[model samples]
Every structure is written in C-alpha cells, then in structure tokens.
Target: MEGRVLITGVAGFIGFHLARRLLADGWTVLGIDNLNDYYDPGLKKDRLAQLEGHPAFQFQKIDLADRSGMEALFAGPYFDVVIHLAAQAGVRYSLQAPHSYVDSNITGLLHILEGCRAQKTAHLLFASSSSVYGANSHLPYSVHDPVDHPVSLYAATKRAGELMAHSYAHLYGIPCTGLRFFTVYGPWGRPDMAYFSFTRKILAGEAIPVFNHGKMQRDFTYIDDIIEGVTRLIPKIPNAQAAWPQDPAASAAPFRIYNIGNHTPVALTDFIGTLESCLGEKAQIEWLPMQDGDVVATYADVAELQEAVAFAPDTSLQDGLQQFVDWYRRYYG
Candidate 1:
C-alpha cells in the first residue's frame, strides 16, 4: 500500500493533510504546488513548512498549467500513483476570473492526464467537487445523477475534469478515480471557506455574511474524514467492467467517482451557532439575498462510497469545529 506517490497540490488543505498522512505511513511522496495567491500564499507556505523536513517527503514548485514543466517532471520519475489536487478552486471567484478556471482546472488537468498517459501510471486520483451536482434537485446527490447543468463556471470545470479523466481511463487504460468532496472544513483550511472565515469574523466581533439569508444547508465533511476516505480509496484501483451498468459513477473503463461527504446536511444558521459555541463568542449576522452561482443545499449520498470502502465520514460538527477553534487560537496567537 505504501509506495512513491505524487501529490499535485501539496500546499492545499486536503493535499497537505494527505501528504502528511502518507508520509507517516512510510510512503515516499513528491509533493508539488505553485503556491498561488488565490487566497493567502503565507498560509500555504506554512503548510509546506510543516512537511519540508520529513525524510520521505520532497516538494517541487510547479504550476499544473505549465506544460513544459510538467513534462520535465514526469520524464524524471515514474510515479506509481498521481494524486492530482491542484486546480483553480473557488466557486465565486470563477465569476470574475472565468479564464483562470479554464487555465488551471481544465488545462492543468489535461497536462496531468497527458503525463499519466505517457507514464501509464498505475492509478490517478483527481479531486472533483460537490458543485458538479448543480441544478440537480435531488436531496442526496448521487454519482449516478447526470451533471449536465452546472450553475457556476467552477462546477463546469470540475465536470469537464471528470469527463477528461474518463476519456483518459478509457483510451489509455489508466485507473482513474474522481473524488467529489463536500463542504470540507477544518484546521489549516482554505480562507475562502465559510467556516474558516466565520471563525475569524466572530473572533474579531464583525458581522459574518449569512448567504441565502441564512437558509442554506451544507454537508460539512471534516478534514480527517476526507483523508480517511481518500486513503482507503488509493489502494482500491478500479477494474474495467465487462458489463457496463450505464452508471455515471462507473464505466466499462477503469474509471470511478465517489462522493466523500458527511451525508448529514446542517443548516447554515446551525453551523454558525456551532462555530460561535466553539469560539466562545456570538456572531453578528448580515442577512443577504442568495448569491449567484450558489446552491441552496448539498447532501451527499455516500452509499456507493460505503459499499466500496466500507467507510463514510462520521465526524460531528461540534467536535470538528472545536478542534478548528483550538488550532485557530494557537496559530493566530
């Protein structure tokens, strides 16, 4: 189970946690990140700083869209597994910077696919998002659902990445797994995420914006749960099925998708209250109309994930937020 693995967004929230976990499990990891300032490069650097000294961990500064750089990288080493997590992440940012999504999410993914095709990589696990369930009114989004209507450019790019991976898997026989992560939040999380920003605003006695007039719900999967699901999936390579079931999640080719989510949707108001309790403070609410490119709720149907890996996210929001609050106090102080 332990082997040399290449993790593309080594400085990212999930990628950082995954790398640390793999390194601890005795895997030699080559982690790469461009360290972009999409949010705060300083936080990304601090994440990297923690992983720099590990004997089994090595890092390279490379942007995924850099085709020549990626070519040079893949030429040097034969990565048994490539965990592609680098992308232009942010649902709202895509509205203002649409081209960046194409550049990073679409083109960047193409480079990764090409490298994997050339290397004939044993397994390629790439990050997708729950945003792909856009315009689908299903209570618990399932991989079997057709993701044709993406409300945001970010969601479109994610769906495009999934299709691209499927094509590569079919043609090149490269085992590819797409992870559809839900509202992932925890310590060392993205600054753009609601929970992270909420913690900061509440601590500073500022009004936190309550999107959708505080009527939205999200399946806030904790970071540890996400890592555990991904770790279990890394070794479970998909085999090409002789009988095609016409399921979007699986194919006759070596491709599969799974929703790694908590499966428990929490109201935005309730989530904020939990955070307030964790921080020992009250939140000033700024109620606002529903933002464009935003969903009213996200609930994951993790039946396939549980059946495949015999595991699903089970972390409580209260405990997860408490851990994040403790980390925030120590890190910010």
Candidate 2:
C-alpha cells in the first residue's frame, strides 16, 4: 500500500476522490486521465488541481484509448498496483454512442489489463457497476447474481470488463478485484448524474424529470463509503477457492467481485424530498416514462463486501445530500 499505485481516470468523480484518500494515507499515486469532453473538462481539471498539490501524487493527461501511451506507462517500473477507473460512463448515452463505450470501456480496459499483466502488478482493482444487474428485478443485487442480460450497452461493456479481468487473473495468476458500485453521489460528483442535474434544475426553478413516475429506487452510496471500501479491499486480493460456486458468476481463479453499496434503496420521491430539504427549495417535477437502457431500480447486496473487506456503504441520504448541496452552492452559487 505504500508503493506506487497507478490509477486510470484520475480526474473522474470517483477516481479523484479515491486518489485523494490514497495520497492522504501516505500512498504514492500515479494518475492518468484523458480529460475527455464527455463531461465538463473544467471539473476534471479542478479535481486535478487538488492532486497537483500533493507531493505523493503524480498525474499525466493521457487517453486510455491511446495504446502507445498506455504501453509506455506500463513499461515503467514504479507502479505496484493498478486501479482502473476510466470509462465512457452513462447508460442512456450508450444508446446513442455505442462505439464510445467500445473504445473507452472495452478498448481502454484491455490496455489496462495488458499493462497489469506486463508489469506483474501485485493487485488490480477495476470499477464495475450495479448497472450490470440490468433487467433483473432481484433486490439487493449480490455479486453471485447472473449478469448475462445487460439492458444497456454501457452495462454490457462493464460486465465484459469483469469477465476479461477474470480471464487475465486465471491465465496469468494476477490478483484482480472488481467493484460493483451502486448509485454513487457526493461532493465532486458527475454533472450528468441525476442528483447533480436535479440540484441544478431545482435551484433554477425548472422542472426536473421524474422517471418511472418517480417510483424508482437506488441504493445511493456516499463517496466516503465508496473510498473506504476501495481502500480496504486493496490489500485483500482474491485467491482460488475450493468451494467456489458453480454459478457462472463465481470463478475459481484469483478474481473476485463485490457489491459496494449502502444496502438501502431509497425511493426516487424520497430521494428528491431529501434533496429539497438540503437545498431549501422545492423541485418542479416532470413525470416521464422510463428511458431506454435504464432499469427501474438498483439495489446492491453488500454481504460479500462486508464479510471480505469488513466494510460497507452506510451513509444516510440526508447526510450525503447535505454535503453535496453545500458543495454545489459553493461551486455554482
């Protein structure tokens, strides 16, 4: 944990937070991000500015799709572990730009895997998503659940990344951990996410979209909880288990996945109500049908994560929303 750690998507919402936490914990971090216009590049740069002040943190602006750049990075001798978080992220955007998912999520991930393999890294922890449980109405989604039918191309690519990581772990004996994150929101959150956009629209006195008639639920995990889980799991890499489930979701290799979530699904209306309370404003609701590539709900079962890492996302909606609202007012006011 003290040695150099390579993090892709260093400027991303989760990535930036994770890097900050790691650096605070005395771990040296090497970060890289494409700074793509998928979101506001200004936000990414602002996040990078914080890391720039850390002596233990070094960052490079590089695209994950750049095979040559990734190769040169891997060719270096400093990285002891790789945490790959860069990807083209949005379920709805995947529908319009399927190739973007392929290029960033698929191609970008392959490069990371290759880099880990070549460098003989100690452990590789990559980001998966609760979206992989698409179309499955099963509550409290467990890592053991079958994720074969992803409703969105984004989800499918993420699931594919998990499988690919498992393959690398099996073939090369590389330690690999995949984190299935729930609805993550907090300070320095993604602008495209519902909570952030809803805050904007509500503050502007504009109507916010209420998908599924505002009946959906999400296990909204806080950023601190997410960072804790990721940090704790860094040292606990998976080993082959003799009693591994025959389920395709289970693997006998040195590959494992855990659902990092709050384990409490709050209704959309309730979530909005919390936001309204935090921001001291009422939102104009615009009811809408479910969009393509969107599931009605996402609930993560973090039992495996708790048993393995001894930690789970436990932050309440009100506390998380208050933190986000405070940051939003300061940043956007």
The most accurate candidate by lDDT is 1
Q: Taking the tens digit of each residue's C-alpha lDDT, what string does model 2 give over 1-333?
A: 677899999999999999999999889999999899989999999999989998898988888888999899999865777899999999999999999999999999999989888888889999999999988877778777788889999999999999899999999988999999998999999999999999999999999999889879989999999999999999997888778778755678988888999999999999999999998999999999988888888888888888887887899999999999999889877
Residue-pair clashes per candidate: 0, 0
Each model's lDDT: 0.95, 0.91
Candidate 1 clashing pairs?
none
Q: Lowest summed lDDT over 10 consecutive residues: which window, candidate 2?
A: 241-250
Model 1 RMSD vs true structure: 0.6
What is candidate 1's lDDT per residue for 1-333, written digit by digit as tens? Answer: 989999999999999999999999889999999999999999999999999999999999999889999999999878989999999999999999999999999999999999998999999999999999999998899999999999999999999999999999999999999999999999999999999988888889999999889999999999999999999999999999999988787799999999999999999999988988888899999999999999999999999999999999999999999999999999999
Best by TM-score: 1
